[model samples]
Target chain A: MELNKEEKAMASGELGEAVKWAINHQIKVGNFFDAKNFVSVSNVHMMIDPESVGIDGVLFLENLVGMGAKVKIPMITDPRGVDLNYYTPLGQTEEMANIERRTIKACTSMGILMTNTCVNYQTIMAPIFGEHVAYGDTGVVIYSNSVCGARSNYEGGPSALAAGLTGRTPRYGLHLEEKRIPTKKFLVKFKPEELTDWGLLGALIGKISGSYWEVPIIEGINHNPKSDELKHFGASMASYGSIPLFHMIGTTPEAKNYSSKFLNRLDDHIITLDDIISLKSQFGKKGDKIDVVVFAAPQLSIFEMQKVAELCIDKSFKVPVIICTSPQVYSDASRMKLIDQIEKTGAKVLEGTCFYNQYAREIGLANGWKRLMSNSAKIVNILGGYGYEPSLSSMENCIASAVAGEIV
Target chain B: MKTLLKCHIGIGKKVQGEVLSANDNFSARYDLDRLKGIFSRPQHKLVGKSYVDKILVLNESKGGVASAWMLYEMCARKMAPKAILFNKANTILAQGASLANLTICDRFIDGDITSLLSSGQRVTVDPMNGLVSIL
Candidate 1:
C-alpha cells in the first residue's frame, strides 16, 4: 500500500489522475480479502460481450490494441455468440453486430487466434496437469484445479493476462502446496458403473463446503473412473459452488503418493449415501416432471459425446434434446459421420456454442425453463439464471428427458 | 483523512494515449454483466459509448491487461475516453497500457480523497471528505 517517492510525486499532478483511474474499474479477481501486490502482465485471456460490457472495459480493449500491448503471447478469445459473426438466438442489434465485428478484427490484427469459442481447453492451449497457468473459464478453472491437479486462481481476463505476463502469480492460497491438501472427507457407499453421474457427487460436495477452494477427499466408490467422468464432476463442482479444488481418496497425482495420511486440514466434513441422495432431491421440485433437456454448458468433449451416442443407440428419446460440443469435437465427429447419426434421431448437435449461452433463450424462456435435465452441473447453474429448475442426472437420463419432452 | 494517491507510471513501448475516467468498480465481484449471466463480461464499458475522447480509468488492475486492453482497443477505434491516468503502475495497468498500445503517464500523489474532491464514486484511492480510503 506504500508508494515510493516517484509515484508519490505523480499523485499530485494530472499524470496521477490517469493511473489511479485505471486500476479501480476492472473485473473482480479473488476473495480480495487476501490479495497482495498487483503484478503487470500481457497476453491474457479475456471474455467479452456487449451486454456485460462496461464503460472502462470498452476503453481498455481499445487502448491496449492501439498501444500494441497485444503483440506477443497468443490471445485466446471467446466471442459473445456461438459463431463470431452471427446473432444470439434473440438476434443482435445492428450496433451490437458492428461493434463485435470491429472488436474481433482489432484482436486478430494484434495476432490473437480468435477462437471465439468458450471451449478453449479443447483448442491448442489446453493446460496439462500441475502446469501453473492462468485461465478465465469458470468450468475449466474447476476442471483443472480438481481433476487435472494444475494450479490457477479464479482469474478473469485481466488477471489471467497479468499472470501470463509475469509468469508468476501470488504464491498464496491454492498456489501453496500445503493449501492444496484435502480437508474434508466423504465415504462413498457404492461404485458408480457409469461416470455420467459424477456431477451429482460434486453438487453434493458443493453444498457441504459452501465455497470454492475447499478440498474434499472422497472415499468409497470402488470403480476407477475414466478421465471424462472426472471432468464432468469437476465442471459440476465449479458450477454449483465456487469450488476450485477437490481430490479423490485413492486417486489424483498428489494423493496417490501419500499413504492417504496427508492432511493440511482435518477430514472433519464427511458425506454419505443419504447425503448424495439428498442432492438428487435438490435437482428438481419435489415431483415436477422435466419439460426439456440440455447438455454441455461448458461444451461437451468427444468422450462425453461418445457416451451419449452409445446411450442413444440402445434406447429412444421422448422429448426435445440439445447437446452442445466444441467445434473441434464437432469437426472430428463429423469426419467420422457421428454428427449425421446423432441428428438423425431427436437430438440436435450444436457446435461452437454452449447450452448456457444459446438454448434457454432460443426457447423464449428468458428466466423460466421448466423441468430441465443436464449431465453437467455448470448447465444446471445457467438454468438457474432463468428460473429454470434443473435435475442433475446421468447422460442417459438427460437424453431420456429430451426425448420425453417432460420429466418422467 | 481522505487520501487522493496518484502515481506516474511509464508506458511500455507498445502503449499509447492519455487519461479518462469512469464511475463504477466494474469487477469487484458484482456488476451488471456478471449479475446478468453474461460470461466474459466487458471489464470496462467505454467502447462505442458516449464519453470524453481520452479517459483516466479510476479502477483496479484486477482485470489485468485484458481489462485495460479492452479499453485501449476502444480508443484505437476512436471510441475510447482518450488518455489514461493511474495512482501507480500496478501490473494490471502496465499490462493494460501494453496491450492497448497506448502511452500512459503515471503519477503518485498522497493526500486525502477530499483533495481530488469534485465528484465521483468508488475510486481506487479515494480521499473522501479528506479521508484516504483504498478499496
Candidate 2:
C-alpha cells in the first residue's frame, strides 16, 4: 500500500510510538485487502464494550494512552457493556464494571468521546452523501453506507481506533465506487408494515445475500421507510449476514442513481410475506412462558422510546422487561417523562448499553432468564447463541406478553 | 503424503494445529460462547464443539464487529482457536486477527476450504506465504 508523506512519518515513529503502531496496523490490513492508498475519513466510531475488550484490551488502551496517543479527528463509541448506574441489579459483576470503568478512562484520556451508542447514525450525527467514515458496529456502517450514502466498511474496534489515531483508513472495499454497485437484486412482493416486519424483511434479505461482498439492490417498496424502521432493518441485516451495504430502489440515496441493468444479469429473488413469517416462526410458539422481555440491539431512539412508553402505560410486567437507549435519547426521554412512563410498569430502562454485548451469558445465568422475548429481531438472533430461547414479536405484543409472562 | 493448499496471503504467524472444519458461517459475538470456548449457537453446524487450540475452518464471517475485540479478549484468557481459515472473510475477521495476532487466511485457490479440510486433521498454516499443508 502506498503511504503519503504524513502516513510515512507516522509509520516511521516520527509522530510517536502510538501513531507508529496505528499506521503499521493499518498498513497490514490495507495490504491484506490490496488497498492502494489511504483515504481521509471524517469521523470514527469504535465498538469496545468491556465484555468484548476484557482486561487485555483495556491494558492495551492504557498503553496507548501512556504513549501519548490522542485522536486526530472526531471519534465516538458504541454502546458500553455496563450501564454503571444500573449494572448490579441487572446481574453485572464488579469485575465487569471495573473493566468498563478502566476502558472508559483510557478512552477519555486519549480524547475519545463516550457517545455510547450503536445508533449514532440516528442519535449523533448522520453522515452525508459521499462522506467517508471509519465506523465500528456493523449496523452503523450499513446504515451510513446504504441510507446516508456514506462510504465505510465494517471497521471493527481495533481498526476504528487505528483510524481515529491516523484520521484515515485504507482506500478499499466500500471506499471505492465500483464495489458499491449491486451484486444481487431482490424484488419485494410483500411490503413491511411495522418495525418487526421491516426487520424480518431485512433479516431474510441478509440471510439470502449471505456474504459481505454481496450487495443487494431491493425493489418494489412504494414508500420510504422512516429512520426507526430502517434502523431495525439495517441492524438485523448486519447481525444476520455481516452485510455492510445495501440499496433500496427509490428509498436510499445511491439506489436512485442506478437502473435495473445494474443487477448485471443476476436473477431477481422475489421476497414474499411467507418468507418473513417462516423466519419468525422458527423462534417460539405463542403462549410460551417468558422469563424476560427486552428492547435493544441497536439501542432505541427517542421516537422508539415514546412508542414503547405509550404501550407500557398502565401495564405491569410479570417478567422483567429491560429497555436500552442511548444517553442522548435518555436525557430527552427523561425530560419528556418517557422514562418514567415506561419504568412505571416494572421495566428498567438502561442507558448506554445494549443487552447482547453486556456479558449476556452471565446475566442470563444470574437472572435465570432462559426464555427471552424481544421486539428487536437483531436481539432475538443474538440471544439465541447466549443460551436464551429467544422469541421475536412486535413492540405492542412484547409489552403485552411481558405483562402476561408468556408469549401472547 | 502431504497435500498443499494455497490461499491469499493472510494475517499473523505461521503455526501448526488440528483442524476443526465446518461449512457454517462464524461470528464470535453471535455464534460463540466465549467463556466456554465452544460454538453455542444452536443453529450452527459446530454447535457444542470446542474450538480452542484448533484451526477453525468456516465458509465466511457473519454478524457484528464485537468479534474483533472479542478475539483478543478470548486470546487473553488462553481460550481461543489456534487460527482461522475461511473461504472468504469479511473486514471484521481480518481486523480481529490482526489485533489478536491470531493466524487467519482466506480466499483459497483450492475450492471450499471446509471441504478441503476436516475435523481432527493435523495441518500447518503459513499465513505470510498463503500455504496450508495437510500433515
Candidate 3:
C-alpha cells in the first residue's frame, strides 16, 4: 500500500510508538484487501465494550496510552458493556465494571469521547454525504454509508481505534467507488406500516444479500420513511447479513444520485408481505409465556422513548421490561418524564448500554430470563445465541405481552 | 501424500493444528461462548463443539465489531482457536486476527475451504505464504 509523507512518518515511529503501531496495523489490513493507499477519514467511532475487551484489551489500551497516543480526529464510542450506574441489579460483576472503568480511563486518556451509542447517527452528528469515516458498529456503518451517503467499511474495534490514532483508514472496500454500486435489486411489493415490518424487510434483504460485498438496491416504497424507521431497517440488516451499505432507489441520498444507472446490471427479486411473515414466524410461539420484554439494539431514539412511554402509561408488566436508550436521548427522555412513565410500571430504563453486549448470558442466568421478547429484530437474532429463546414482535405487542406475561 | 491449498497471505505466525470445518458464518459475539470456548449458537453447525487449539474453517465473518476485541480476550485466557480459515473473510475477522496475533487466512485459490479440509485432520498452516498442508 502506498503511504503519504505523513503516513510514512507515522509508520516510521517519528510520531511515537502508538501511531507507528496504528499505521502498521492499517497497512496490514490495507494489504489484505489490496488497498492502493490510505484515505483520510473525518471521524472514528469505536466499539470496545468491557465484555468484548476483557483485561487483555484493556491492558492493550493502557499500553497505547503509555506510549502517548491521542486521537487525531473526532473519536467516539459504541455502547458500553456495563452500565456503571445500573450493572449490579442487572447481574454484571464488579470485575466487569472494573474492566469497564479501566477501559474508559485509557480511552479518555487517549482523547476519545464516551458517546456510548450505537445510534450515533441519530444521537451524535451524522456524517455528511461522501465523507469518509472509520466507524465500528455495523448499524452505524450501514446507516452512515447508506442513509447519510457517507463512506465506511464495517471497521472493528482495533481497526477503528487505529484509525482514530492515525486519522485515516485503508482505501479499500466501501471507500472505493466501484464497490458501492448495486449488485442485487429488490422490488418491494408491500409497503411496511410499522418499525418491525421495516426491520423484517431489511432482514430478508440482508439474508438474501448475505455478504459484505453484495449491495442491494431497493425500490417500490411510495412514502418517505423517517429516521427511526431506517435506523431499525439498517441495524437489523447489518445484524443478520453483515451488510455495510444499501441503496433505497427513491429514498436514500446516493440512490437518488445514481438512480438512472443503479438497476442496469443488477439481479432482480420481489419482496412481498408473505415473505416477511415467513421470516417473522420463525421466532415465537403464539401464546408462550415470556420471561422478559426488551426494547434495544441500535439503542432507542428519543422519539422511540416517547412511543414506548405512551404504551407503558397506566399499564403494569408481570415480567421485567427493559428499555435501553442512548444517554443523549435518556437525558431528554428523563427531562420530559418519559423515563418515569415507563419505569412506573416496573420497566427499567438503562442508559448508554445495549442489552446483548451487556453480558446477556450471565444476566439471563441471574434473572432466570429464558424466554425473551423484544421489538428489535437485531436483538432477537443476537439473544438466541446467548441462551435466550428470543421472540420478535411489534412494540405494541411486546408491551401487551409483557403485561399479560405471555406472547399475546 | 501431502495435499496443499493456497490462499491469500494472512496474519500471524505459522502453526499446525487439527481442522474443525463448518460451512457456517462466524462472529465471536453472536456464535461463541468465550467462557466455555465452544460454539454456543444453537443454530450454528458447530454448536456445542470446542474450538480450542484447532484450525476453525468457516464460511465467513458475520455480525458486530465485538469480535475484534473478543478474539484478543479469548486468546488471553488460552481458549481460542489455533487459527481461523475462511472462504472469504470480512474486515472484522482480519482485524481481530491482527490484534490477537491469531493465524487467519482466506480467499482460497482452490474451492470451498470447508470441503477441502475435514475435522480432526492434522494440518500445518503457513500464513505468510498462504499455504495449508494436510499432514
For each candidate in turn, the TM-score is 0.65, 0.99, 0.98
Candidate of highest DockQ: 2
The docking category that best describes candidate 1 is: incorrect
Interface RMSD of 3: 0.8
TM-score, model 2 to reference: 0.99
The candidate maximizing TM-score is 2
Model 1 per-residue lDDT tens digits across residues A29-136: 211223343332323455554433344454555665664443335556543433443345334345545555665666566566666555666554566676775555
Q: Across residues A91-193, which tens digit of lDDT does each residue of candidate 3 receive?
A: 8899989999999999999999999999999888999999999999999999999999999998899999999999999999999999998888899999898
**Model 3, which residues run further than 4 Å from truth?**
A257-264
Clashing pairs in 3: none
Docking class of 3: high
The chain B TM-scores of all candidates, as shown, are 0.44, 0.98, 0.98
Better of 1 and 3 by lDDT: 3
Comparing 1 and 2 on DockQ, the stronger one: 2
Residue A282: error of model 2 in Å?
0.8
The candidate 1 chain B region of ten consecutive residues with least summed lDDT is B28-37
